[model samples]
Target: MDVLIVGGGLVGASLAIALERLDLRVGLLEATPPGALPAVFDERNLSFAEATVNALTALGVMQKLRAPTGAIARIHISRRGDFGRGLLEASRYGRDEFGRVVVARDFGEALEARLADATRLVRHRPMRFLGFAESGDDVRAVRVADADGERVLHARLVVAADGTRSAVRDALGIGVEEHDYEQTLFVTRVRGSRPPDGTAYERLTDHGPTALLPRGDRHYGLIHAVARDQADAVASLDEAAFLARAQETFGWRAGRFLSCGPRSTHPAIRVVARQAIAPRAVLVGNAAQTIHPIGAQGFNLGLRDALTLAELIADARTIDAGADCGSDTLLQRYAARRREDRERTIGFSDGLARLTANDAPLLRPLRSLGLFAVDRVASAQSFLVGGAMGYRGDVPALCREVRA
Candidate 1:
């Protein structure tokens, strides 16, 4: 194999698909088998910008998603301390929708189905990575244990996409800097009497930042960031109490919260690996870095990594017919290309988490003012749109509109 991808989650699977399109031999190893979409409805939702939508569309997976779903036409941001209040409308930018929101299971299922159809991918499940040894300039031998037994697979490059607490990254002796926000996020789906009006809401409150993303039906995906100690109490709260608290902090934008689905909580933290690349290896997705989910940058950033790496491989193949698909030079180039965007995104998300978590009077006004300015300033608005849409640098072919 030219590349061995550790982790068969969204990032790894997406990377396999992207690389296979370039005629690269890729192997995907997963601890668990890919899951099927739930028969009943579930609440997990994803916020995909125009660029991400375009990328997935080019890959031919987006068309399989069930649509007429959630499309964010506007975004409303507000702070607890009345410093700035802002609203961004798609109409102002001559766009029909700022982003599209889809159910998480649907997205996962579609990607898995596509992978099953791709011929260049070798899928291994119920598998675990044992270790790896660098053989030469063009090879790294990896040992993996699966249902049958143990086997050795040699590949030119190893890409880690196993997620935040990646075992592959750890085995590679890659150091990481982790910042625990000491905050917990409560996520659930709630059906409301009123529609979302195609608007997403980000409200900074005393507890933390809460977001209400639109969903199919009359329900909305709710993520409430709160202190760790408060999470249990909030989670245990009755539906009425939870709704009351939600409404109290969120205001009356989406009317009233009626009932909620199963609520889940996750600790909020920012984790960045000390290095993204090693000899004959590279880390992508949460394996490289995991940020607080304040801005929904986690998955989008991972997708960018997958797309960029694929583009580099495609370019290399076009240059030399017999080129090593996972050359160290190519991995180095991919690392360098991704540094700026990764740093900027991590810094922005971490800063936003801290700024919103504070109750400082002075900072409040500044944040509010910044939001107002972003709303009023055309350039700022465009920048925000572009960033949210995942179009930071030279967009890859897959990220662009498919040429007819």
Candidate 2:
């Protein structure tokens, strides 16, 4: 195997597809069998930046997705304190949309279909990775066990896409810096009287940042961040009571909230691994970093990780042909390429979360003024668009416009 990917979630599956596109032999080990996914789309709806959408489109997965679902053409961000509001419209940037929003399940299923069609990819289901040993010159042998028993699979590279609490990352003796915000994110889908009008809203309140992302059929994906202690009360509230509270916090931006689907909660934490790569091993997706959902950077950042690593691997193959490609030097180069973008994104998300989570009087005015200034400043708007598009530095070829 050229690359052994652990975990068959969205990130891992996408990584396999990306590598196979380069004509590389790839093997994926998944604890879950193929064609199995959660029944309904998770309450979460990921905001796909233009770069992410383009990358997925290039991979041929986007074509499988249902069309006319959820597209965010505008974004309205405001801090509830004294911070004034800032509105960003796609028209200003000469584009039709800032990004698109898709239900988690839909995106996963589409990627799974594409993976099924890739001839260079192999999948092992219901398998557990035991460990690995450095075998030949530049070959790492991995031990995996399934219902049939155990065996060793050797590969030039191993990618850990297992997720935030990554077992492979721990086996490599990598340490992560973790900050628990001590908050719980309550997520649900709400049907309202008025349509979203292609606008997403982020309201930073004293409790936490509440985001209402536009969804199909006059529904919105609602997320309210609150302290852990207060989560039970909010979750236990009746429909009317919950709607009232949501109305109070979010106002009538999408008109009155009529009903809500099942509610779910997740603890908020910001995690960054000290290192993303080791000799013969590279961590991608949540295994490398996990950020608070304040700006919807969690999955988008992971997608960027997958695409960046794919680009590196493709470049190495072009240069070395049949030679061993996954060396320490290759891993180092990949790390260097990713370091700045990772640091900048983590800092931006953490700073935003902390700043909005508080209600300090002095800080309120400053935030408001900053928002006002950004609205009037073209440079600032461009910076925001660049960041949102996942082009922090040395933009990847696939992220740029497809040339003739």
Candidate 3:
């Protein structure tokens, strides 16, 4: 195989689909079986950037989605007890919407359906990656186990999309810089007294940030953040109580949250791989970096990582069919290409998470001024919209514009 992707989750599956048109052999190894539910695909609501929507649509994944997705026509950002606030309207930027909201489970199902039709992709499921070895200068010996037995698969390059606690990354001896936000995030669906008008609200508090993302089916997806110490109490709250508490924290911005669905909680943390590549292997998605969800940049950034890598690999193949896909030269180029976008995104997410959570009196003025600038300045608004739309660094061709 020219490339073997470990972890058939979102990023890995996306990479496989993106490379289907390329003249190269690709294999996807996933632990989950064909009919089993993937752990990464749950009831979480994901905010897809415009670029992500375009890329996925081009890959035919979006068209396969059976569930309806909501459009984010506007974004309202504010801090609790603060006078300054920022609003970004898609029309102001000459766009229909900033992005669309998707259910993670729905997205996974679409990816699965799309992968089933990929002619150039090979799948190995109900399989777990054991480790890998540098078998030859241009090949890697990867060990995987299934119900049958363990076997080795050789490939010129390996891509790790296994996630935050990636076994592939660990086996490659890559270290991560981690930060515990000391906050717990609760997500669920909620209906407000007022119907959604394509507006998404992000309410920042001293403890953490809370978001009400517009979702299809005329409901809003709620993301409630609280300190770790209070997580237990929040989790134990009944539906009515939870809705009441959420309303209190978020104020009446989108009208009172009338009803809410089941709640799910996740501990917030930031993880960044010290390096993105090592020899014949490379890391993508959460395996490369996991940032706070404040800006909803995690998956969007990961998709870009996968697309950029795919672009480079396709280019290499176009130039020389006999090229070593995992050559040091190729891996180094991938790292250099990803550095600017990766660092900028991580810094934005991490900095925003920490800045808004700090209650220092000095920070209040600074934060207010910053908000004021972003709201009042056209250039600031353009920059904000550009980032929100996933325009950074070297954008992939598929993500550069909507497909004709």
Candidate 4:
């Protein structure tokens, strides 16, 4: 096989699909069953940037979703006590919408359906990455355990899409640079009396970041961030109590929140791997870097990494039929190409996680002023909106390859 990808989550599955378009012999080993979805795709909401939508469209992954998808016509960002709110409208850029929102379960269903169609791709379910050793100077021998027992497979390259606590990364001795925000995020689906208006919200308060994302069924998705010490108390509240507290913190911008779905909590942290490329292995998705979810850039960045590597491999293959896809030269180029986006995105997310969570009295006015500037200044609005829409420096061709 030309490539063996470990971990068949969103990034890994998408990578497999992208590489298949290049006619590469690809093998995907997923620890779960053939059709079983990973835990990462729980009933949470995912905001896709325009760039992400383009890439997924090119990969033919966007058309398979069956659940309701909502468009974000505008994003309203404000501070709790601020008078001015920053609003980014799609009309400003001549775009129909800034992006789309879909439940992760719908996305997972689409991915599982796509995995059923394989022309030059092989998918192994209930299989895992045990470790690796030198098969030869040209390739690495990968060990995996399955129902039939452990076996070895040889491939020129292994892509780690195994998530933040990647077993593959751990096996490779790749160190991770991690940051704990000392906060926890509570995510729930909420309903308001008002109808859905295609607007997403991000409100910064003394508590933390509160996001009200629109869902297709006129329900608003809520992501409330609170200090870790207060998470348990918040999570244990009754539905009525929760809604009351949400209303108190979030205000009446979206109307009164009447009901909410089951709540889930996750600790906020930024995890960046010390190295993304090894001798014969490369890391993508959470395996590479796990950024704060503030800007919704995690999956977008991971998808870009996959597409860029796929494009590079295709270019190299055209010149030499037996090109070393995992050669040091190719890996070095991948690392270099990813440097600017990776650094800027990581720093962007890290900065947001810190700045917004700060409760300093002196900093409040400055932060509020920043929001006012983003609202009033066209250039400032463009810069912030550009990043939110995933138009960072040096956008790759694949992100611009959407057919529609």
Q: Write the per-residue lDDT of candidate 2 for residues 1-404, one digit (tens) a residue.
A: 88999988878888888888876778999888656863323657788888888888888888878634577888888876564787888889888887787878778778778887899888888789888765876778988899899999998988998888888898889999999988898888888888778898988887778899987657898998878889889888988898788888888778989998878888898878999998788998889998989878777778888888888888887987774557888888888988888888889899988888877877887788878866777887777777776677655567675512
Model 1 lDDT per residue over 204-301, tens place: 87667889998766678899888887887888899899988888888887888889888877788788999999888889999999998877788888
Error of 2 at 195 (Å): 1.2
Best by the TM-score measure: 3
Question: Candidate 4 at residue 51, lDDT?
Answer: 87
Cα RMSDs, all models: 2.3, 1.9, 1.0, 1.3
Candidate 4 ranges beyond 4 A from true positions:
none
Better model by TM-score: candidate 1 vs candidate 4? 4
Instruction: State every prediction's TM-score relative to the real structure.
Output: 0.95, 0.95, 0.98, 0.97
lDDT of each: 0.82, 0.82, 0.92, 0.86
Residue 380 displacement in candidate 1 (angstroms): 2.4
Using lDDT as the yardstick, the better of models 3 and 4 is: 3
Better of 1 and 2 by TM-score: 2
lDDT for 259 (candidate 1)? 90
| Order of the predicted models by lDDT, top scorer first | 3, 4, 2, 1
lDDT of 4: 0.86
Report the number of clashing residue pairs per model: 1, 1, 0, 0
